[model samples]
Target: MGSSASKAALAATTEEPMEPGPKHLADLTQYINETHMSVAHLADILSKKTGSSSWVVVFKALVTVHHLMVHGNERFIRHLAARHSLFTLHNFLDKSVGEGYAMSIFIRRYSRYLNERSLAYRQIACDITKVKRGASGVMRNMDTDRLLHTLPVIQTQLDALLSFAADPDELRNGIVRAAFRLLLKDSLRLFAAYNEGMLNLLGKYFDMRRSQCRESLELYAKFLARTAKLTRFLRVAEQVGIDRNSIPHLTQAPCSLLEALQQHLASLEEKKDFLCPCGLQHTVTLSIPYRPTGNACARRTWFADYFPYTIFTLPSPQACWSRAAKYGASIETDASGGTNWQLSTCASTSAIWTSVSGPPSPHTVTSTMAFPPLMSPQSLVSSPPGLMADELELTAWAGQQSQSM
Candidate 1:
């Protein structure tokens, strides 16, 4: 069959118009409102018009619906889901990590334009995303999946925006198009941290393969590296006053980490300030492991350990500590029984406790006192859920290191 006829037939079956224009938009609005069709219906419509398969149609429909939501078309969003099972509506939308990435890029894009009123729409879009899941029945959290999904969209948008280099307004907003580019750069720094977390979480029903893990890691690194080529375009966006905060931090983890890796990179280093890779040259906070060499009366100085952990903001400190405490408790006892001397030591050197059951293991106990100004017992007490991994690691290491010393 010829492509156009096939596409038309597909759209006819699903009941969506094939072209972009006023009538097309109006018909889609009416179809969504009046029929409340499921994702399968939307996919069928898209496949018929585009000669693409049901999968592509469904994916495109998700992006379209998300765009509508961002544009404050709640009537459209509600109309579609109200008619169909929301889970069935979302099944095709969440097929792969790339679809998620594309939708997220659009969200992050329009989210930049959100005022307080539009934030409601943004929240609704986020809430609706919970409907889909993997075969294991584990639904991916929006925060965790946001970047993974948005990266592909960011690339697609960037390519489209590049086609409009002649138009300054489109050119200016191109930073929105290039959102994940910075992440493609400096992939190693983020990947190192990412790997540590994955390794820690691997056995917990994640269903990750080594190849998938490596591909994911490489994709992330490439995104970080590509940011450089797009910098000039981004600078133009900033001149027009785009809100950088709309998107989550590309340089740091969207969530928190457990083992304080003893590496510290300042917030500015996070591809946010200047650029990537070279951005690492910016001032970084370093933590070195130290062991006391002198007697009880002697003054001890912290010695440098080659291993480093970069610190970033953590959303929840107490929760992290609680979880860490739980994990520690699972393997051993409270272990908080001995002298409190570790309190005065630098965050890097805090590893005093050894499991007395056998040979001295390398397991170290760190706390959350290292952050000089940003994170304190006072601050740690206040963080919301979804802890920032870097900040938690820094605070935990600092607190633990002090006690060890």
Candidate 2:
């Protein structure tokens, strides 16, 4: 050979690309599409292969499904029946059990996808749960495509995924961070939608075969706890493959994952007795009387529901005082009769004694020894402080005139 021919021959032998056959080329796509029909087609192909007697066929099918599922044209989903494809995909996952170890790998891959998709409904799970019950027959019928035996097989698939799931490597696979977030969202949904079926599903993965369910829970707990160290809520849904807003509620069963989560979160939020509105700490003192009466007497206990930036004026401070006096006002009490937050401090002995010293103003004092000024509720509602001051001054002046008479 000539020198040029020799160099060309060496280059061809060393760097030649293996020409992919037509079948292999058919299975591979350069760009992943997110179309529903394409995804369904890919899944159907996978299901058929998963049921195949040949391991190579099953493996190739799984590769094809994974490729299409992740990289398929997302826009195609608009034209596809999302619900139908999910059901079909889930069905394939169910039958994967009989397909052996390779099948298990495919199921695990599908589980990752499921985990991702489930996360998409994080914000709307409750809304979906509301519509979950009383769904149309068509919706219910869709899930019934497979027999119970085939359907329940997904629990095992989930179990296998848990077994093989690793701590998503952040170095090479920083995608695990997103996975963690998606898993966290899934955990929330599982807690919210915790029905017998889902609980059983979680139980299967946690108790029956592998410990990864428990491990993931622990890892998530640690992650969330660490999140508490930071003030802002973070978004990690896409990492885990969840939509965070795609929760679809097809029915409303009593024991759904949404219900469980709602109950759990309700209990948690209720346990918080205090709220710092401005994220600042300040003290508020309230005094309760020994025998509160009238409107004030009707008042039981006061607790701050929300913080007020400034003090609000009451229509009748005396009415409040009369209520407080009934209880023989105590400084130690943290609460008073009104729901409105009011700042209080103990009155000096002189302030109390001075009011009582000349109080032979019999007409102004009621039989209960509290102010009995004849101010109507309407007048109290209208003028408030001015009306109250006028009433008190008139009462004192009337008493002095009566003394002179």
Candidate 3:
């Protein structure tokens, strides 16, 4: 492509979605696809345009990049993915002073998503290449793992795509309008990949890590809620002039469809190994089993005499005795509370125990229990019902104990 022709097409790209009209876009794409233009030259122009102070220019440049990626040459994609710094757009800013161009945040985010998309596509292409090269069946498992890795990348890109997710006001911005035309276009495809891959993961890979599987489902549920919320935004999308054709998937994919998929995933996840919050999912769990024979001020939580499930969250029996001697517990000591994350559940009982002494560990059995805060119903939501009454009764039983174990 002649420098003059390339310059005209770049100049033609303005706020109007069709400004760099199809012909100009076609000719420019042809140059990059056919190698008449160097990928480096296109990269430099895209970098500068995306990094512009004007949000309009940035949005248009992003559209151009999207255009070429969708309709341009394969080499261009590889070059962009490998040379990610060329389009990082991490600090891209919009200095246009107006309420209309409320797209700086959206543009910055969309640009990053595009970068991830490019990288993701490159990985996909590599997998295809491996297949064509007659890669052995051994590569299959490795590829599955790679796709699992890509799941979150796609999820995050989709999240960023919806920066103005349900906000009709922000979605109305001209830059936002143009950006979504392309952004949603890519998102629809990415959404398919994510949903499909998730199904495969749950269906074919039954042995996948429980924590990863559950976390993926939770993230998927988050997307389902967003889509349900997007219904209103989509109605506004048409009122604001976004093409119905471009967002067919966005408008057609039902929330129920996603919900069913989520439930399926959850059911499949349950069939896998159970993940105990006993902290054993990751590293070692410290069991602080405390028996308060002499003290009456400590809280009583997760005091299972049998150590039922061997859940690491349950303090070991012998450890409880040692813990009684070290930290100590009392039924009447006013219980100070801790955040839920700091609390550990007992495998033997459903009660969640908080460590009044230190991090809930082996040193935190019955002897180190922290009682209910304020002794009010609202303050004890995490604990079982009538826990206050039980603690009071237990306190009465302990008040008469000798000052020795």
Pick the lDDT winner. Answer: 3
For each candidate, what TM-score against the reference? 0.29, 0.24, 0.51
Q: How close is candidate 3 to the true structure, as a TM-score?
A: 0.51
In order, candidate lDDTs are: 0.29, 0.27, 0.45
Please identify model 2 stretches exceeding 4 Å from their true place: 1-43, 53-56, 76-99, 102-405
Q: What is the lDDT of residue 266 in candidate 3?
A: 51
Cα lDDT over the full model 2: 0.27
TM-score of 2: 0.24
Clashes of each: 48, 43, 20
Error of 2 at 217 (Å): 16
Models sorted by lDDT, best on top: 3, 1, 2
Summarize candidate 1's per-residue lDDT along 297-355 as a digit string, tens digits.
22111111111122233423334334433334211222442111121111111012222
lDDT of 3 by residue, 307-346 (tens): 2211113344345445444534222222342212132221
lDDT of 2 by residue, 194-233 (tens): 2222222322321221233333232222222221211111
Best by TM-score: 3
